[model samples]
Target: MSYESITLATIAEKTSISRPSIYHYYDKKESVFVDLIIQEYREWGEQMGPLLERRCSQEQF
Candidate 1:
């Protein structure tokens, strides 16, 4: 469900959700984009956290 850097029209078309529904959740397109960016960053951080700790442990050796 990734739609980064895409137009609202494209997102609406892809999700089969209306533009008004999207706005209802996000208030504005920029808010939706920002929320998407934050979600990606959070997911990346979660995925990398363990790997980063492993690297740090190795470096401490």
Candidate 2:
């Protein structure tokens, strides 16, 4: 979905976390965007951490 289609409520629902809990860490929806991006990126990086340390052909990469 497009960024415009996503909302704090959407995130809260998907994560099963309350809106109030999310708001506690974020002052605004944009802040939620930043946190979500960073959190997902970090999780992705962690899952792909080993691959990052390995050297492979560009095609394989």
- Which run of 10 residues does model 1 get worst, by summed lDDT? 52-61
Backbone N/Cα/C clashes per model: 0, 0
Candidate 1 global Cα RMSD: 4.9
Best by lDDT: 2
Task: After the best TM-score superposition of candidate 1, give how far the Cα of residue 55 lies from its true spot, in angstroms.
Answer: 3.1
Candidate whose TM-score is highest: 1
The predictions' CA RMSDs to the true structure, in order, are 4.9, 2.9
What is the per-residue lDDT of model 1 for residues 1-61, given as tens digits with 9 covering 90 to 100?
4546676766677889998777668655677678889999999999988787764555663
Question: lDDT of model 2 at residue 3?
Answer: 74
Tens digits of per-residue lDDT for model 2, 20-58: 897788776788778779999999999899988999988
**lDDT accuracy of residue 20 in candidate 2:** 89
